[model samples]
Target: MDTDALSPLLSALRDAVLDGDARGAASATERALGQGVDPQRLVDGALIPAMDEAGRRFENGEFFVPELLVSARALKASQAIVTPLLAQRGGVVARGRVAIGTVKGDMHDIGKNLVVALLQGGGFDVVDLGTDVPPTRFVSAVTNDRVDIVGLSALLTTTMLQMKATLKAMETAGVRGSVKVIVGGAPVTQRFADEIGADGYADNAAAALALARRLMASGA
Candidate 1:
């Protein structure tokens, strides 16, 4: 399909997903597939771009929690439909493997989820450990999954400390240098990342993608 023709379908899919209309989103996804839409395009062109807009709108105060939730719901719905197709196409090879999670005591997951979406869009194989993940869990994932990078997230200042401790644990476990570390969240800053010996830090999801790619390239 031409870009022009695909734009509206893509938009509709975004709307449907945001509306939490799973059936409608699924219908739209099927239609796009029938029209020979590339599965990657559906994710990168449609879903990820829409979520990026949502994130922008959120940062600008044009979108509130309800709006963000709706948009995320929609994107996830569309993802459900398209991801399987992408999987069938020999599964997208990640730029690198990453194990990601919210540090212990920090239950916030919105930012983590957004990062995961953006990472997936950027072609990373992400093993998400979810919210309130312990330091040991992160280490185990790194060891078991052989991930190229480890991303630690914390939304609260109190919990942000967990990231540092987690890094320390990695060192004690003798796997600190085995993988690059990236950290982020509302309370995190580039300075803090440096203080924690993190290889990189990003303020938001888009920047996270760029940083992840750069880290992978430099490490490789």
Candidate 2:
């Protein structure tokens, strides 16, 4: 575990993720763990940076959905190894808990799925509610899962109204103030988010991760 030896393994893991080499990423993680590298270090130093780079590439249009998903799969490969060790040692501290879903009446989930992967890579414990999710289901996630943030997604103008309805459901459940709400989708806008009283909005997966981090930092 000397500095020189540690540096290369970390680099290998990072490169594997950025290159979308899931098998290599997993093998690197295993080798690093066997070499006595701290699991948390692997996560914070290699995995996080790799995902951040992937997100950057995505935002710059240098990476598409396929590329992003591949990178996420690589991260997942590493995390599969690291997570259990962290759990055993009580070393992993999740940034936050998030519940994400497409609002009711909108079956589109491409954007939501992308955001879900990025959020997971960003170190948030995400509960993916899939597409055409009911507002009541979101409310249940907030109350039962004790999630810190709720992400509502809609690809249609018609379905966007469901986002507002979802918010209203949270209000009715008296948990509106307890959790921060973020909205996004192809047709979603800042003005629409403002009108719906969302805490934040993001146009893409990278922005969603950034917005989630900001919301956590601001205690929103």
Candidate 3:
């Protein structure tokens, strides 16, 4: 394995992530790591760029939400291997802590799962509350986990209304002001997020990570 011939390995990793092929991405990551390619190099060179490109395609209507979610999952598969190695090298940087869930009555997990992968890829410790998460569970997770951001997801118009209920529950539980709430999902809109008093709104997982970082940076 000529370390000088890293281009093929790097290209394979990038293409795997872009194709949303989890096993392929992970296999490529393992080969890269075994060949002594810098883990940070693979992350910066392959994972981030793949996700960024996915975001661009999503925004341009060349790719849909599900495709982006699949790509995020693939990035996460490779990220899992790269992260621990980066940590051992004392090179891993955590952006923030996040607790995210699809609101109660919304059983959609793909979007929330995508956000989970993206958050971890962005170097945040994420506490995933899973789909159809109740308001009590959201509050409990935030209070127990000490998360920097709380994210609500809803894939249906009816389920999006649960975001408001969840917010109210958090306010009643005295946790609303303790953390920033960001909302997203198919039916979610910026107007709805603002009306519900959410701190931020993201149309997709990549944007969710950016929003979480900004919310945390704002001291929320």
Candidate 4:
């Protein structure tokens, strides 16, 4: 493997993802692989860092939903090419597992989807339960899927009540203590999270990712 060729390919992959160019990302990923770049290196060195930078930009108000959505698309494209290879080689190890969804009665998923992408990029295995998810589903994900964290999203003030309901369900099912619960959405507040006995709250996707990592570090 020529070090000179490898560095350029990796840089191309990173640039494509940061620019939200999905096709360019995939093409660059494939070229890098063909040139004998390590799959793990692609994931750790290019994909993860690019997403981290994207998250940073979003946190700093330099990017918004449109930018994040496209960057996530590019990351997914690159991951589609490299993830399977990494899996076969046992080179990928999840930092943790998270189950996330929009609480019942809420059809909104834009924020939830952004959190999922950022969490995945941050090396956690995320289970996206989509929109309008009920308490039972959250319970089942905890009891059966064994996720380390459960994220509840509610874009509407009305649907926010479902976060508390979900927490109650977890307690009743004997899974509440086993996982950390985080809440967020346009209408959610840290006070609401505390009132509902949640483990944490985040205002946006970047903060959510940081909250998750902190939770994992503290053994939640």
lDDT string for model 2 (55-113, tens) is 78988999998998888888888877776554453225788999999999987664576
lDDT of each: 0.82, 0.87, 0.83, 0.86
Clashes within 3 Å, all models in order? 2, 0, 0, 0
lDDT of 1 by residue, 1-220 (tens): 7889999888877777656576787788889889888876776666666666777787899889888776666666667676555444333676888899999988777567767867877788889999999999999987899999999999888999999999999999999889999999978999999998999999877788899999888973
Residue 117 accuracy (lDDT) in model 4: 64
Q: Show the colliding residue pairs in model 2.
A: none
Candidate 4 local lDDT, 174-195, one digit each (tens): 9999999999997899999999
Ranking by TM-score: 1, 3, 4, 2
Clash pairs detected, candidate 3: none
Q: Point out the higher-scoring one by TM-score: 2 or 3.
A: 3
Model 2 misplaced regions, further than 4 Å: 1-91
lDDT of 1 at 19: 62
Q: Write the per-residue lDDT of candidate 3 for residues 1-220, one digit (tens) a residue.
A: 4545888888899899889899999999999889889876786677767866887798899989889878878887887787665444322577778899998987766557667766876788888888889999999987899988898999788899889999999999998888999999877999999999999999976688788888878887
For model 4, the run of ten residues with the poorest summed lDDT: 83-92
On the 0 to 100 scale, the lDDT of residue 44 in model 2 is 67
Candidate 2 Cα RMSD after full superposition onto the native fold (Å):
7.0
Q: What TM-score, to 2 decimals, does candidate 2 have? A: 0.60
